[model samples]
Target: MLQTLDIEHRLKSTLDEFVADWGLDAEITAETWLVEDLGFDSIDVIQFIVAVETAFDKRNVGFQELIMQDGRYVDDLSVGQMATFLEARLPAA
Candidate 1:
């Protein structure tokens, strides 16, 4: 089974590649905000969520529940939070 730490590491790596490929001008960390800190608008956020789903090789994973509120992303949504969310969704192996 993949440990929690392993999942987090993979999540971080995936996010790193996402940021690089998109040419985002912000540092990605556990506490980095996707919309505010990373400069991701609504469309970018959707694209990023798709990229993360692909990166983790998981489908139908919903991140909007975690990041969205009142039709907008919550300001405090962080990379670490997303990692934690993914860790729960990904099957252990």
Candidate 2:
């Protein structure tokens, strides 16, 4: 697996790629709200979901784990939290 610190870099790169793909300049930080802060609607979320799935070749696990009631956690996932999730779930290096 990637080093824990490296995960943040990876997340930033992934977010950068996603933004570039979508022609968006909205900054995505660990604290950025995907909806309120970034203005990501359902289609944007779905596109980001697809990008994340493709990043790890892990299908759509993020969305899969989120039911309708997941609420803010879905948009408020921090870099650290995403790192933890990816470390546990992604294939070992």
Candidate 3:
């Protein structure tokens, strides 16, 4: 199984690529907020989700549960939060 730190590092790398691909001028870290820091909209979030899935070589990681609560989309998410969620769902490696 991948350790928590491993997942965080990998996720951060993926985010770095996403930021570059979008031509975003920002530094990514565990505390970086997707919406507040990156200025990501809903469509951007969906695209990022796909990018993350491709980077990790996995799909259906239940991002809905992470992005939604009480039938409403959450306002924002930090990189660390996403790493934790992905760590739990990704299979052993």
Give me the candidate number with maximum TM-score: 3
Residue clash pairs of candidate 1? none
Cα lDDT tens digits, model 1, 23-82, are 666766777877778777777777778887887788787777787778976765677788
Clashes of each: 0, 1, 0
Off by more than 4 A, model 3: 21-23
**lDDT top scorer:** 3
Ranking by lDDT: 3, 1, 2
TM-score of 1: 0.75
Clashing pairs in 3: none
Candidate 2 lDDT by residue in tens digits, 19-85: 6766666776665556666567777767766777677677746454552344443544444556666
For candidate 3, the 10 contiguous residues with the lowest summed lDDT are 17-26
- TM-scores, all models, native as reference: 0.75, 0.64, 0.91
* Comparison by lDDT, 2 against 3, better one: 3
Backbone clashes (count) for model 2: 1
lDDT of each: 0.75, 0.63, 0.90
Alpha-carbon lDDT of model 2: 0.63
Candidate 1: Cα lDDT at 24 = 66
Stretches off by above 4 angstroms in model 1 are 21-25, 69-76
